[model samples]
Target: MPNSEFSGCRWAVVLLVMAAASPSWAAPIEQSDTPLPADCDGLKKLSLPLEDAPPASMASSLKGCSSEDLYFGIGVPKDPVRARQCAYVERQDPDNGWPNLFAGTGMLMTIYANGIGAPRNFDIAMKFACELGGAPAEEEGWLAHLQKLKNENWQGQDFSPCDDITSGAAMGFCEAHGAKLASAARKAKLADITAHWPSAERKAFAALEKAKNTYAAAVADNEVDMSGTARGALSIAAREAEDEQFLATLEKVISGNLPSVSPPDLAETDNKLNALYSKIQKKKDTSDWGTVTKAGIKKTERTWLIYRDAFVSFAKRNFPSVAPESLKRVLTEDRIKSLENFGN
Candidate 1:
């Protein structure tokens, strides 16, 4: 048989074995027609081993206990009887040890998938998976188990057990593995952002664009060259047409609206903008432009800061007012902390 086919067969056999061993199949719980015990203590005592007790009697004995308690071994046999009282108890109360078995199985499966239990052994993996009782485990329980596996196996390595297996039994495993992969992908993305030259170039270009837009608007409106700064800023703005195009392309990428520009085109744009800025700065006479130029620059800087502050203020002010007071307080405090951090 092909390797893939053999693996598939192996999984099928494993599943079959698990199904056969499950308590629901091997030792089904019984429902009784008899009346229940009076209270919790009576229920507990009544559930204890009873010689030749019918399935109905066993069920009646557990009447007042919660399902959780019933499943937790409330009326278990501590000794054997010639009439097979223990056997009856086991048959009628298969779930007596289910919670512990479920937990152990979950833990074992996680260790196997993560390779933490026996890192180099496929045999151990198979063994652990088999012991997990084959597939009736709850999805959430399995998920939690896989998360624990991920935490154990995350040692500068990215291993995903979910990708290799797909069974209802492994749903939790897949979810946890997917979550880890997503986290890794996010970190990779953030790294890409840090190394990217375009964002920095875009910021510089945006500063120039804002200066140009303000100067152009002032000129159009016939506002005083009250800040002689306008002419020099206009000169810098004129040199930024190529940068403006590059910034437009980057903005599209940052906003997830389009593909990124080619690296060569980006490099060429960066060089061109740097050269233009250098030339403009060399020609700019900050000393001779008079207070108007200084005033205009200061005003532009103030406008940007105001815009930033307003956004933070808006976020805090419009936060869900209907939320619990404690939640609102936390949100308000966190916002204030963030603003302080930004200022620092």
Candidate 2:
């Protein structure tokens, strides 16, 4: 058999075992309450101010400029003639006017920090940072920029110092401002995705419902031995329904076959199943069917852990190697300093 097919079968077995063993009440562990990092306080105080405007004529010429322009403008090649042409175009099209100077300035600061146009030049970096610190309109732009950073495809990037620095800076700035911003953004995105989830959820529910019906029929016919696969399939279907995105995509595939079920209803069903699994596992009788189910669930959990570890190992292996000294200074030294200065 093909390797891919073998892997798929292996994963199915793993999932089946985990689902059987998992306690109905097995919820994700919550994080412990740790004190906020000390350097976090100082980093919070670091604000970017906007620098003075360009010459009146130059500013006019940049009228129709955009965030993209601002991104390219700072330290980008300047052609007075082309800029004049752009200004003329801006005069003709008011709706597509150039990006606000402050927004552009913020964008420039981001670009510099990200090392987009140049190598890691801390001098220019400090300049733009100081500019952002001074700019009044920079707050909104900076916040929006940070959101963009959060949404960045980090896994796809080459992962250079330039890119990573901007990411770290964006994260630090967001944290300094308030970690709530990141949390709120994540929640908002999740909400948006969940809002349109009815169809996907309905489809998942139908699949589970079908599985349940099938199992019930098997039991009625006294075919208990043949019901294991159906029960396993039901567990998988129910779990898939709980995954907002997966359900949404699956809904498309089984469009007309979906039942009229909401996400909340599906969620409740999942919770009930989890609780049932937990109850079964707690039973003392080792020779009972509940024990067999619990064992299968344990196997599933182990398989999931193995799968997770494999991906993590793959990521670690593929990650680009950076200079040890650079890593130590950037990741460790700066963090240590930030912590040391936090309360002071």
lDDT of each: 0.33, 0.32
The best candidate in terms of TM-score: 1
Pairs that collide, model 1: 143-172, 227-292, 229-293
lDDT of 2 by residue, 219-256 (tens): 22221122343433233332322233323322332333
Off by over 4 Å in 1: 1-119, 136-169, 195-252, 255-344
Best by lDDT: 1
lDDT of 1: 0.33
lDDT of 1 by residue, 1-344 (tens): 11211111111101122322222222322222243322222222222112233356555553432321122222332122211322333323434232222123333333334333223222222333443443433433334443444444433222233333444334333332233333344435544643654665545434544544553343222212224323332332322322333244333334535423454554554455445434433445554433334344334334433433332333234332322233223222332332221122
Model 1: per-residue Cα lDDT at residue 29: 22
State the TM-score for model 2: 0.21
